[model samples]
Target: MNSLTRWVRGPWTNPTASGLLIALAAIFSFTEGVNPFSDGHAEGAGALPAALIASDLLMVAAAVVAGTPILIKAVRALMTKMIAIDLLVSVAAIGAVVIGQYWEAAAVTFLFAIGHALEARTMKKTRSALAELVAVAPDVAVVMRDGKQVEIPAAGVEPDETVLVKNGAKVPVDGVVIGGTGALDESSITGESIPVEKGEGDEVFAGTISGGGFLQVRATGTGADTTLARIIHRVEEAQDAKAATQTFMEKFSAWYTPGIIVLALVAGLVTGDAVLALTLLVIGCPGALVVSIPVAIVAGIGRGAKDGILIKGGEYLETSARISAVALDKTGTLTEGKPYLTDVTVLDPALDRSDVLGWAARAEAGSEHPLARPIIDAAEAEGLPVHGLPERTEPVVGMGVIATLDGQRVSVGNLPLLTVEGIADDSGAATEVDRLAGLGRTPMVVTLDSRVIGVVAVADRIRSDAQEMIARLHDAGVQKVVMLTGDTQRVADAVAAQVGLDEVRAQLLPEDKLTMVAQLKADGYTVAMVGDGVNDAPALATADIGVAMGAAGTGVAIETADIALMQDDLLKLPQAVDLARRTVNVMRQNIAIALITVVLLLAGVFAGGVTMAIGMLVHEASVLLVIVNAMRLMRRNEDQHSAGPAPASDARELQTAGAGPLS
Candidate 1:
């Protein structure tokens, strides 16, 4: 019994069968141009001028072939206590048959079946991107177990196992290259066309193909824990999720289908025109309108996933499109997050660059601070030995470090550290610090026994694509690009100016960043915050959209961020924004197409021009038009980064983005 119910509920309807039946019906009807809707009634009971019996038999057969599934679906909807589109199509087809309009019944059901078949085929194409992604999942792995290489299923490999990836082979797991070297075609993971060089200690993900060279990777994650699996899972959930407009359309379809049935019944009772009433029912499926928003959203999100941008769902996509202001964290996002020794300026003239750098390195030796490494690294690079740790190292939060070396007080810190130590710098050292900071270099003022010696500056090099990202944000219709950093105001301003940022919010801690985002939202700006997705969690949660950069290795980043750019490339941020805007544009276009088609069809049905067959034809055409329009998003992306300024966003729907989903 259960098997029978399931079989009946499934897509048991075959449009091809109906097509063959309709062809025979059209041939036997002997009407002009093979029109099936024409009745071939005989002049007399004994006469055979019309060949009426044979024609009616073929038409009824076609109607039964097409309408069986519709009736089954309509019966299921009745059991579920709902008024579905199938119910409307079934009722109209049955009504035509009751009134002896055999050809009309066959035509209506045949057109409806064909429309569904076309939608199923085209929508499958729209999802081709995701299907391609799933197809890339690694199937086999060569693992070094018990000191011998053994082949096994990809999912059977255990964590921490060393997996071998050969040239032109798929990487079987997300791991680190502990030995060997290779380049990977990470286009599946990062959407980068060029294969990335992977040396010892470089991270590699599953689903990437090796271009050349062999690599032995120690797996960090296996099976569903892999980044590729996570991406596929996220995309599947996103496609199934509904957008705000799609939800509204569904509710509208629910009542609208029933209302059409009610209107048809009233029209038939008042005017006694069964054909006109049946025509209304035939056109009242809401086929295009019901699908307009979701098909656009699915295609758009699927397209982004192909490019390694993972948007959470419809709400984030919609909100991302309205992002007028973008807030960015400084470290790791704008810059490389690794400060390097850029300059060493001597203020005392008594000592050279080596004296200043040597003292700074000795003072900061073995220090874990981000700035300490650059100074120590530079001193060693110039053959200056930094063998021992400083005797005493004091790290002042948000200020530079002060350490004691060889019992001589050595201070290597920003200008504020001098004030904190009550030390005097009258040797023109502040002027040198200003000079270096003005050029976007973070200057560390060096002091020896309360005497200012020289200033050694180390700055995190801005990413190569930072400037391009800022410009592209503007081109994508973002009105403002702001920098929020814990760096001092001078350093922040310098980086901001070089990047052409619209605003800079410096000296902010993690919580302060959240307050700033909330302020932006309260000011009626749709704000998107881009960060590392961990330290910036508060701010990211408070913004309209939270974008995680370089999220390939970070599972939490991929899972939690509203949108995750798999690579560290800054250019993907602007590309994501551009895609979101394009997606919203497509959704609105589909909506407009659906609404216009409905209005036109309704007008045609009420006027005397449209028959039941004509109404079904137009209805099917409109549904196909909507599906075809959405498929445009799956086309190859244009130059989204350098495109002209985009259309202004609608802030009304996204006003409370920081609070929750699109209102």
Candidate 2:
């Protein structure tokens, strides 16, 4: 029975099904020759109309047979406030038939159901994009230990354990590379068109593709701590959030439906015309009124999906549209969040670049630091031969690396290491290193035989998409976009300017970000903060909306966020806002049209200008009108106008298409 029920209620619930029944009934009605008008005599003129009404009634019966469970569920939901408007609309539809406006009632019910099914189908399509993303998350991880490989549950992986990631495998945890190198496909993570090269010590997000070489990664974060997990969680939370428009509609329906019924009853009593009363009832059904909000919501969600934005629910969709300001956390939001080999300065003119890089990679090997990874990667790429250290290496926390190579003392770190070791200042090397560091670069100092030889400057590269996304947001409706970073002001400003951000707040701690967000709120602005680190959790919680970049299936909890823009693509933020705004506008238009139709139809009957049959016809027409109008949401892309010259060009192209060749 469950299988049968599923079959009947599945893809079969569509307008085409109802339309077929309606068509069949119309044919039967044409054969009957009954009058459509109540005033027509039974002999000739009325037979066709009467037959038509009978046909419509047959179609309605067919619909009730097919939609029995839906009707029951609608009733149950309304009783429980699970679904409000659908319940009242269903009841009103039945009341129209009980009052003898069979065709009017059937038409209203059929149209409403069809519209709902369409809305559901469209919404499902829109939501499928996120489902696709969810489907890609790895359920298992490959753990490597003591030269053996083992597959384990992704959630079971622990921090600091080496995990073997092979080609095409989804990263199961956030970790830094310890061995091997590979090209990673991060399109899903960053929304960029290119793949990124990663090597030892470079941090890779869970769920991104390790495209080529095998890698051994030491897991730093797992389970709910992964960025991807946080994104999925945030998306779900956002979906559950409600918007003001939905709330108003619920409140309106509570009184609106009952009021219509009472007005119809009053009209019936005063006019002493039962048929006129029935027409009033038919007009007051609110079929279109019930369909308005959901259709717009479905359409908005669909639009977001097309642009790679996944908004979990209508509530998040609504809130995104109302945000006034957006706060971007610098580390991963505006910058690449990975160190890249930006520059190499050789102080000892005789020291070959390749040799220096190889020494640096071997010296920094096994260190879980961002700067070390790029140096190692650069050495490997240059095919520089790296030899194992002759003696054990000691790590100076917050300083650098100290080791012995070929029985000679060697240290590669920062200026602090030289100052603390009582080594000669080497003013030339110090000045050059300071210049590089000042430009947002991390300078790795190399010391051989107790003297500084060279400095290799590495910096976290800015993400290719960051600047474009920021500009897109401004174009899409964001009033201002700002970057907040813990990095030096010079580094933050450099990245911010390149990314087209309106402002920058640099050298701020996680707490500082929270304070800044609070101040913005105090200023009466709605702020959306985007971040993807544990340090960002508090600010994410405090902002008007928190967007976590867990597109790679890492970082699963964004408890503070009202809306979670699931993918790392910052552009989705702007796309979602536009989708929300357009959806609200469509909903408003639908409600207005539905309300006006009901009011005008009731006025006609009360003024004695409309008969029961005319009232029913007009009432059904309004339902049809609203259904057609709601369908217009599906075409919103055509109606969507860009802000400037782009839309003008589109308009011209549209004009050309419309003009065609001269007839």
Which candidate achieves the best TM-score against the true structure? 1
Query: What lDDT tens digits, residue by residue, belong to model 2 across residues 1-663?
Result: 699787676755544566677677667755865433232222344334555656756656745643454567677876786644455445545655566555555555565565456556544654454565577677999897677788899999988888888998888888999999998876544444367888998888777887798888999988878766665554444444445676677677777766766776787688776556555655665656765676566556544543435566676667677778889877666655666676677777778777566667777775655567677788878887655543768888778878777676677787778875678766477888767655556667887767777777666656655656777777767887887777666666556555678888877888999998888889887788888747887887888777756534433433444444545655566656666777777777888887887788778767877654355456556655655555554453532334221111211111100000011
Count of backbone collisions within predicted model 1? 0
- Mind sharing the TM-score for model 1? 0.91
User: 175, model 1: CA deviation in Å?
Assistant: 0.4
Question: Which stretch of 10 consecutive residues in model 1 shows the poorest summed lDDT?
Answer: 654-663
lDDT of 1 by residue, 186-239 (tens): 988887778999999999999999999999999999999999999888888888
Task: In candidate 1, list every pair of residues with a backbone clash.
Answer: none
Q: How far is candidate 2 from the true structure (C-alpha RMSD, Å)?
A: 10.8
State the C-alpha lDDT per candidate.
0.81, 0.65
Q: Which stretches of candidate 1 lie over 4 Å from their true place?
A: 1-13, 31-35, 40-52, 391-399, 402-408, 416-425, 641-663
